[model samples]
Target chain A: MTSRERAEGPGDGIPGRAEGTGDGTPGRGERADAGVPERGERADVGVPGRAPVIERRLHPVTPLRRAWAPLAVLAGWAVHDPNAAQEQLARLTDTMLLLGIAVLVPAAGLYGFLSWWFTHYAVTDTELRIRTGLLFRRTAHIRLERVQAVDVSRPLLARVAGVAKLRIDVVGTDDKDELAFLSEREARALRAELLARAAGFAPETAREVGEAPAHVLLRVPPRELARSLVLTGATWGSLCAALVVPTLLWLFTENVWTVLVTALPLLGTAGASSVGRFVTEFDWTVSESPDGLRIDRGLLDRAHETVPPGRVQTVRIVEPLLWRWRGWVRVELDVAGSDNSVLVPVAPRAVAEAVLARVLPGASVPAGLSPVPRRARWCVPVWWRGHRLAVTGPVFAARSGLLCRRLSLVPHAKVQSVRLTQGPWERRWGLADVHVDTGAGKTVTARLRDAGEAGRLLAEQAERSRTGRRDAPPDRWMTAR
Target chain B: METGSLDGTGAPADQPVWRRLEPGLLRVRRLLLAVWAGVFAVAAGLLPGLFAGPAWAACALLPLVCAATCWRLLERNWRSWRYAERADDLLISRGVLWREETVVPYGRMQLVEVTSGPLERRFGLATVQLHTAAAATDATIPGLDPAEAERLRDRLTELGEARSAGL
Candidate 1:
């Protein structure tokens, strides 16, 4: 059977009618009064104030094609034993059984090939229409206005072929599936068209950086990448193993091809990891675009993701121990309705601090808020006390900064959970660590060079944790419960 | 644990008595878990053997392993598990090595579902699951008396409805 039939037909459990509209026709509800313009007639003209919902043709993966794969596998298996001519002749002895599989092999293949051939998509001034089917034909209709976020990802193979996949996620619609697997050119065009539609076509008003813009933030350089390779344990170990082990193995076999296949993915992984470190170390940038903030990273993919600032629910800044010496911090933002967190892998101390300031301006901890005062506290675990710490008179503090260091303020309103940690090594050095998590997942962590102050801080924060709310109250509204 | 008398005021006349866990039941649960673990280890070791080498003894061990995994997961900390209604939330604390404490505040609870699997039904026990907006954050307090589970469910539902109406 055809993929559309499989997608829409009885067994799949998805009902016949499409997403929003009750009937097979596209326009229903208030959309009927929307006065959707006819295709190609002054394509830009619709309701004067609002952007027109351009209906474009989108093609989805065919079920016929998905089902054809198994048949192709069986066919390939049957003819795979080329050296055994007698066996091949004997394979035909089971003619009745073979006929059933062989007939499906060609029939399904022809159907899949024909379905792909006929699939066509076009975005008109009014709506997006995708029509594909072999026998039981169907169309997928999506109103351009409802689209929420557009994500584009290209595998290495797709990159070589100059083809990328596009996914258009829409809000308040149960279409069961979004747009996927479009060629790179087609994907870019779709993104641009939808973004333009969302922005409502005020040409000069469009943000310089947005979902449609190709401008990127982080790019990796070579020298920094090599340094990062030596620093990263995983990368360093693999490279050393690659150089030494292969030389020993080469004595057994002169063949270089066997060594190459095994070495390439590992070398590529180490190089990619080193490049990631380079991007994190140097040329880190996050800039405000008209639509949202554009985050760019990677040496290869050179990805650009636009996060609408309004959607941001929480901001997190993390400084793990290894990264502290290099003065690097990772920043992550949590947005509403999304399960995934958006992150900037590596930012210089100043850039990370600035980004945190913009995203979480309320994260200023009052100096006197803590009952016990401590000088420059390091946000390290107690087990990691070999790191430096600073103390001023009565207060115990540990200070660590990869580059530029800033203290995180978890206003009483934001505090969620407070935890204290210590290990055998920490006990030996008289050090203790304290971590206070806010409702936004932002943590104000301090590893005291002196154990006494870390204990006091942990005790004080635990008392505050009882009243921490889901959202940080405004500074003006901060109240002690 | 002491049962407190209710007063006309919100607070009870007397606080409920809290006791240390009964040691004998705790030991029994630990013994059961140990057996379950032993079964699981044997099963995991045999799974790869099924695909590569067909040993009848290893194949025979599969069912026992599956049963042990399910049994251990169901009643890992049977006796030490406790549920107490604090000022705001219902707290569930259990487990031995990796202890867990989950607080289901009345306002955040979406629904309270009390379910009984066959083994639970045979034991006359019920589990109340408090679903929240986030799937991962939901809490299930297992092995409660049937009547108590129903009462807790009623209280949670009433509070949830009141909170939804901005009370």
Candidate 2:
């Protein structure tokens, strides 16, 4: 499934049209030349004032880029097995590698080309429609109003080719319809236009920035990223990797425990993952835009997230064991569209609190909320100080965790369901867990000592959810105060 | 530890006591188990050709032993299935071992359905299903009188409309 969106506006008209001409340039070196709508093209829109929904194909470079993997595989097989290259073509089995490459290379290229050619997307006045499928053709229609966010991203190859990917996140669907391999310029313009339109704006009079003006909230430079890596236990991964070298030496030089062998791989894998996280999320920048928060991160593959107002369903303030020593916290939002949104990847407690106040005005952390009952102590003895929940603000908040202090907030309006569950042990302790769920399956549960509290929370959250569903404005973007 | 009331109404003084399902449900459970035992009996009849006499005999008597266990568990299950209509929400508590009490608010109810299967219809019984936004919260009150099921559906639907906040 290739996801590419040229949601960027090339000045509101035919975005992918080459600047000077609609030349069918040679398919090999595919570089999209974004264009302003020609007067004739604008007239062709026929819808007097509205921008025409042009059914545009993905940038041709998409196929070539996608085909790289298979081509690389062919090259790898030939290089790795040099004997196969030197072998005489006496039999079909002897020439197996040659036959494999001949079949796979062309097949891979064809697949990529067909995939790029078959996928076409267009945005009407109210709906964004995509028609894709080489064999099993499928067409999806997403109402503009239901669109959550449109993110623009470019990986290393796409960046080199001046192409970007556009992902349109919607409600209640796991599938994020994407338009991959649009010209970077066209993708940006499309993102601006489509996002503006999604936020209830006219195509021509698009806010461009959507109203959440560009105010940098957080930026992680190389030094800060290194610091966060240490703070986030990524350094432990580094230590694990470092230990592997000595462990390897010990295995050959001295008697080693069987436990050490298994632990080595586990530690090394964990360490590598942290290193990977640090590398990709190296240059981080979180800023406020006209309509929502903008997150731009990645090293080789720069990614951009345009989270519109109210896209977030919940906010979690997580403090790792090490971070607790220094009183630092990382803020993440549970949004419907994206998997997880890190509002503040890592910040001091005060800064995190200040940010929570700015973005989610009435949200409160566990410490700010009511404490769990004394009897409920058994449920969370280690983090009794944080095992708490409250429903005084515009949302319900829960706090728990021992090694990591996690405070989660679920606004009343977006709540989909409330369930009160009790395991045998929890029941014995006269405790119950209240799960506050959203449609996207984001559930926040609070373990309450008082069964009554859990019940009350369930009832109250249900009411809150009902009221919230009634045209509740996504979120109050702090444009002014 | 005396916890909070089911619906946050401070344990209504006149809160309706949980009502049990129709006795026919026990019969339904037994009948289903009998069907399974019948299949097992056929397997047991054929087992002597492959297994030892003792193993074959044990398999042959499996249906009788299985029927008794089903009788006891089904009774316990039927005994445990109870529901209460509170002022603000409907409460259901069930389970042979791990007891669960689910409190669904009237306002959060999106749909209520009345349905009956062949056996249930034969027993003049139906089920009232309540659907909330969360699939977990979607609940079913089984083995009700057809009339009672219809009445509950109408009442719940009415209350749902009056109390519903949103999807």
Candidate 3:
């Protein structure tokens, strides 16, 4: 529906909360209620009557960044323009460029200015409400309880301008409710307050909007980044890009400068960005706070991600062929909100295990996991690669991979489905594979290859899944027990 | 119906009663494939800068090769397609050379959708899709009688609820 036809009257259903007003003001009694939770039990009291109350604008400097593209295009033309010989022709080109600049300046400037001017957002006790439109008004309301994660990011320009973008992702869908272009202070405050409130409850006077120091768990130093750069396969991408294109172009043009001139831009942009990203996340650190695990990493576009305890659906531990030799692996958490957030980019096995233990209390692969049936040797020749699985009372664990060892873990209460698949080769070998599905679509926690074991596992997992679904907490996937 | 051992690592456990898809599904698939081959033949034979081209002979042979391949594949695929419902899960096996068998548990099913396109409607066939939280667990049974598809959907939905009591 178009809000243009009939303006969507703001928050008529909100009890005692003001509408989506342009100014950042809560309802009359909301000030007493709007005190967002910071440190203590005060969050619970402020949550009940909460309605997205404060309406505010994005960063005022957004116009500069938004209008910069047209300016950059003009500069590129000035440097690259090859036809500037005749005075009359040059004047004609100059006039057109001048006219283009004139039209573009106001067009981009006004567009950015108008969009920022029209956008508005407020924090309700139970929801985050946003109304933004240049011509046709659109409003979005995100339920506080459903706000699984809130990340505050400051990119290169935003960092310089001291502004940040706040992204709030909910469960089930890929949609993220965003409120961008806020001052650093505003972004941090909104994130802490919103996360506190969304963690199922918020106190009336709970005051930290956090930013409190956390107990440091792990850190990635510059040395490790250098090591990772040399070890990680992504470096090959840069190698291919730098060499392959220039070589092909040399064959065609036969002029070495032509190759360098043509390929320089590609190399400069790709190499710089990738290197920047690597450096940005160079000094990575995982720490603990009252809210949960607070992650601080990144260089150019620095990101602060908060993952609450028990919020993860599954965890995947992978070791690349090279990393395996060094006994290193990466740990990623599959929270319902965003895609797999790397818990650790790369770490020693002991370090990863320690972090995993602390984040997931009472979680460990049960000893003496049942081995895959004997004939599985044919299906997976790397039998000695530690292809093992086990289902204890709380978690299900599967370990596999020859060059790279991977261990996938899912809690019993989180099992979504159990599947049994048999390929023609496996059928010929009288074998089949059983896989268990979870919230994270790409990561399978259990994959047991066997014929008889597949059937037994199918029946067993079916029962386990049924029980998990039956007793699952009423509140999404976050319930601890 | 064929029975097989359910022992671990080698053969499957107790066999299931196999049920084939609607016989008309084979005819439907053959007709669709024939039309595709016919299109290739007509395009090569009719459309041209000139019909007397170097590719003219090869183009004429395309339809025969395609039709033959289609016939063999369709027949083999028809024979390969079979499904069985166990006590708590459903098993489907298909593919001629790279055969695959998928077993879906009833308890984990989140949605059961019954759909039929215009062509299937004309042929009195429908498809039923069972969805679970895991994409791997999702399964589709096609070319069922409309009435049969409805019955299975209802049964699965009811069983799904009964089994999905936790979380």
Models, CA RMSD each:
12.1, 9.2, 8.6
| TM-score of every candidate | 0.53, 0.74, 0.73
Residues A1-481, candidate 1: write the lDDT tens digits.
0011111112111121243322243332334334444432122343556553333333334333267478577577766655574576566657766887789778877876776654434453334555555565655554443333445655445566566655443332343343434656667666666455444544333223234444444433455445444555666777777766667656767679667766677677666566555643344346554444555444444343444423343455556545677876566565323333545555566766666555443442123322212332333433332334332221222333443333343334333334455654555556655654433334445654356766665544433433333343321111221
Sort order, lDDT high to low: 2, 3, 1
The i-RMS of candidate 1 is: 13.5
* Predicted model with the maximum lDDT: 2
lDDT of each: 0.48, 0.67, 0.66
Better of 1 and 2 by lDDT: 2
lDDT of 3 by residue, A336-378 (tens): 6564378888788889888887666577656676776676667
Q: What is the lDDT of candidate 3?
A: 0.66
A338-371: candidate 2 lDDT, tens digit per residue: 6547777777788777777656655555455677
- The 10-residue segment of model 2 chain A with minimum total lDDT is A12-21
Ranking of models by TM-score? 2, 3, 1
Report how far residue A58 has shifted in candidate 1, in Å.
1.9
Alpha carbon lDDT at A293, candidate 1: 59
Expressed as tens digits, the lDDT of each residue in B1-167 for candidate 2 is 22224444466633656788888877877788888888887778667736766556566677768777777988998898888776556778777666566667666665567778887788777887776545556478888888777766766665555555433
Candidate 3 backbone clash number: 37
